[model samples]
Target: MWRDHLTQIIVFAVLFLGVSALGFFASRWRRTGSLDHLDEWGLGGRRFGGWITWFLLGGDIYTAYTFVAVPALLFAAGAMGFYAVPYTVIVYPLVMFALVRLWSVSYRHGLVTPADFVRTRYKSPTLALLVAITGIVATMPYIALQLVGIEAALKTMGLVGASGFGRHLPIMIAFAIIAAYTYSSGLRAPALIAFVKDGLIYLVIIVAVIYLPYKLGGWGHIFDAAQAKFEASPAPNDGILLNANNQLNYITLALGSALALFLYPHTATGILAGRDRNVIKRNMAALPAYSLVLGLIALLGYAAIAAHTTPVLKDNNTIVPALFDGVFPAWFAGVAFAAIGIGALVPAAIMSIAAANLFTRNIYVEFFARDASAARQAKVSKLTSLLVKFGALLFVVLINPQFSIDLQLIGGVIILQTLPSVGIGLYTRWFHRGALIAGWAAGMGAGLWMLYLVPNPATDHAHFGGSAIALSKLGLDTPKTLYVGFLAVALNLIVSTVLTLVLRAANVRDDGDDTSPEDYVADRSTERSSLAAVASESSGVAASRAAS
Candidate 1:
């Protein structure tokens, strides 16, 4: 057993060291003179051209959890997991509609984070804080899932053990390495590493899709094997396609997830990191290539069935890695492992940094200390990024790793609740800011409460449970099941709209205007706005020149 895993351990060591070296050296790759500014640290100088932004955003959005979980879900529960593929496909077009405008306004106004947009758009720091908190909360578990992916890979290579200290050893070291470079280089590190991460992932997936089907007697056999297994299962959800009861749930979840994807702070960070509007447009047009890869990756779950692969970890989340081990040579397996391992680091670091930027810019500077300087704010952001990474590490180590992955799904649902405040607000200022806050409160409560009601099939527990809402469980339900995320978001929009109208009727004042039509049309060349320079300048100059 130990010998079988020795090569994987060596591979991991090499790759982690390589990534760490890259992270440590990233500031030089896109170096400006001052490294202590938000532009250099937080948004990677807002200077990534088309190709870099494509790989960086691709690496950030398509994560290690995706590499691990989508196949694992397909392997365990049949076709339900294919939801990821459709969601990814639909998301780019949905984002394409708004991303250029988002970049334009953010760039023109020197917005560092999405919450900064919220603060300016609605002129309400309270609403901005709500968006920031939701983003951080939604993102923490998502980062933890990256550790879960690493854990799955380790377990497949027979590298994990139940001895408390030993099982956590690799995770602790990984976290330390990630946190070190992220603290030092900030967004630049992840932006640089993303090229390697996405390239490796595309190579691994391309090779696996071609090689695995051949070894298994072709794609037809793979599909036949998967179909037979689900046909014989007693559970109703074991098939590849949704039933009549779940059709709405599937469609709504896909759409809701698409809507929520760009609202994520990491995604916004990637969008803001682009060099110009054309880069954003070209990247959006190109991102669907990754979605195509995602579709093939999901098909690997069926390939697992054809190969008769069993789940390697204590839970069923290790299907893809297990498939890799069973079907590929040991050295190639190590490459696959490294692909997933590095993939996790790219997004986790970006998410942590994005969350930190939100806190430093919107919360700390907005409320507690209005007089904080840019250097001090950058320092605070660096420290906050460390804390965020540590918090994510806690979830992976202290909680069940399976539960952590489950929480990422819950995070998606949670993030969707912010659609009204961030996503819709990007397009229109019709919703009263106070109504937006009320809507956020109501949506968050309902989403959490409904999430609390979901029960894990394995443990039959309350929290970190399945998001599928059983129709029969609702008593009055006839024959339709619903995704908790869809229900929650629907209720969120309903409340937001109703409250907005009521406030308008009551003559409640709207917040000051922050964005104009021309502002949304401006790009990098048209506007030389620097978030760092503006942060260091007079607040009155910044505010009065824009909105205040």
Candidate 2:
């Protein structure tokens, strides 16, 4: 069977190796100075212009999950899978200006991670440590999910025969390559490789959308097939239409995802790498176009059903890849497989680098070596990245793939808890550090408990089932469920608000803010001391006091 797919295997190897070569070459792509500094290695010297930043951010945000897991969701869950589309649509407009402010303040302070921002904004090292730890923990499974995206494709191609260790060997080899380039080149590896990755994705998607529909009747027939399949199912929620029971869950999932998107350290890494506020602003405006593509991609699930394509190993994640292999010529199917493979590479690199940056700056340098030079920090970050990727590899090897999925779901909920501390902290210093920590603790507790209560009917798991939970769990008298992230964050905000009042009234001694109101507004164009020379080199900053 593997021998039958040799054409595809060769094509995939060629493209995968080519990108690995490009990853090594990226170290020289934009050589401002030595790659010794964390600023240079971890953040690409923070000099990415409009187009480069556009592709890099696109690569980071629209990952292999976009290609595999999302469509897989549509294949399995019908309309609920479509939530990714709306959440992406909602995120860009919301963060367009908000992130610009974050960029400005971070640029001014030479901040390398969101934890660094928290540390500076509240003058709380303790809170910064918490933020950094959350990022590293959250990213491990997120990276493992990326590997799943690739493994799904590999299995579809018949490259990995049977199951067990041999099935994952190719993935291990690919990540070994990824780990090497990432350690050597840092953020530039992903930033540069993103161009090739995005171009391939767009080409495959365009061809699939137009060509697949023609081959499998029309759009009308595809929908009819999907609708019939779902209607015949015994599941309570599996139609093209969103029923009343799941409506609240859908809305809250979308909104909560939108709010939590940039709060992830990897997303922030991409945004912060922009050369100026204008680049980020332009990107924010233009990036919604990906959402349109995402919706089209989700439709491929329906196309697979219309084509009567069976998933490899009965794994829904392999549906899109299986669809391509079943219908398209071997050559084009290989191309599609390569797209999914490269798709995994770009984001995995960025995520490892982002997590590494958090450790180097927030934990390592902050605690162990306060006077650590930028070069020393960069070395630590490079090593940390390898460890992070290894941890992700362990998740794939030792754990059930289902737990990887659940962990990613839980990862979003876990990261959302930081939004009040990092996302809101960017615009306002209104909340006390003690209150932020307490609020964070409460949100983490509630989010974990809610996730524990969720059960997966598909897998027949009794706990840690999924992201949505029924209102009855909270003593409400309805069948309507809400996103765990959405509910936990509301509880987080309430505790933060009430605690802030309590702490302020008690005159609790605050560490005070290290950032001035002007830090958000002033850029390199306008001098704020010797720092203005560095800040003016690029552009990005929000007004000191933006309206909430």
Candidate 3:
């Protein structure tokens, strides 16, 4: 079965091995004095500048799943999949306002994780611990979603085994390579490999959008074909054009996703790695260019329909890869597959590093090893990253890809609950720590309950059918659907507001904040003295104090 794909496989092998070499050697690219510190190992020394920041953040935002699953969702569900394009558009402006403050404060305080910032800002270890654990739990399934992208590409290339362990071995081996390099080079591995990954993705997307459209009888024919297919289908909301029932879902999903995207620890890991606030600002302005690319990528679903390409596997995630294999030459198809497979590595490495940093800085150091040295923290982070990656590997292997997508939807919902404390708290300390904690709990519980009630007929699952929740399910008279994250977050904000006022009236003691007003606006150059002083405070001392 693999004999016919030898050319494609060989080309993919060369590119894969080349990037693997780069990942292993990335530690030497920007030589820091030591990789013992969390700053050095977990965040690429926080010295990434304009172009590096652009590519790194781009790679972090646009994952293998973006290439595979977004198009797959478009192929399977139509207009709803285009939610990602607008979500990307909406996110940059939001980040421009929110993340610059976060970067300034994190840089000023020498904070390594979002939970670390939460701990200091709220002066409450318990609240920060919730933020840290949410980040880890939300991140694991996201990492698993990236593997789904790789699995889809491999299945299209006929590189996967027939069943059971044989089918999963390729995925495990790929992750092993990623885990090894990430363990050695840490964030630097992804930071460097992102360049190649994004380059290939752009090349493939640009060519496919231009060439495939012309070959498949242009955009008009593609849309007509997709529309015809959806119109004939029995599903009410699966058509090419957005209906009244789905318009709310589309808007809310896009906006909710935009808000949730930056809340994940990996997103912050990318932002925090920048050299200064200007690096973040400039990249935010320029990063919208990827949105243009993403819009084109989403249209590949329609293109696949126009091409009359059937997914090689039962999974819709394989639709784009199948389209490539059927239409493009074997060698070029190989390039496209390589783009996706390599794309997984960049985000997976960053995510595991982010999750591991959260575990090391927020949980392990805060609660378990108060006297742990810098080197000890780095060692723990490296090991934890390995465990996180393998855990994601197991998740993908054991569960279905459709279920993985549902979990990712739940992940966005789960991570959004942190906005009250992390994103909103960046601009104001108005939210009491206790209030924020209660809000997170309320939001999380509501989100999970909604997800549990959604049913996916395709997967024969009763819960976690999708991210869209029906208004009728929420006791509304209308049949319209909306993104569950948005509703849950709204509930969270209301609960937080009412509780903050009540707590203040009752004279509930606030956990006095550690951050000064000036800290929120401090930059790297302006805050050199403060950064130096904070850096001098050993991790052990900080952890011990945080614990006490």
Output the number of the lDDT-best candidate: 3
Model 1 per-residue lDDT at 95? 79
Q: What is the lDDT of candidate 3?
A: 0.88
Candidate 3 per-residue lDDT, tens place, 360-468, comes to 9999999999999999999999999999988888777766656345657778999999999999988889988889999989999999899888777876877778888
- lDDT, model 3, position 345: 90
Tell me the TM-score of model 3.
0.95
Runs off by more than 4 Å, candidate 2: 402-407, 527-548
405-455 per-residue lDDT for model 2 (tens digits): 455677899999998999888788899889989999999999999988998
lDDT of 1 by residue, 1-548 (tens): 65777876688668767977999999788776566888788888888899889888988999986788888778777777788878888888787868888898898898988888888888898888988898998898888888778777787777777566878776777788888999999888988898888888889988998898789999888889998888888665657766677677777777777887888899999999899999999998889988888888888888988999988745677888888888888778888999988988899899999899988998899998899988888999999999998888887766673534475678888898888877887788889888888888888887788777777666557564767776666665576667778888888888889998999999988857778988888876655566556666877687788983
The worst-scoring run of ten residues by lDDT in candidate 3 lies at 398-407
| Model 1 worst lDDT run, 10 consecutive residues | 398-407
Predict model 1's lDDT versus the native.
0.82
Error of 1 at 41 (Å): 0.3
Question: Global lDDT of each model?
Answer: 0.82, 0.87, 0.88
Predict model 2's lDDT versus the native.
0.87
Model 3 residue 510 lDDT? 98
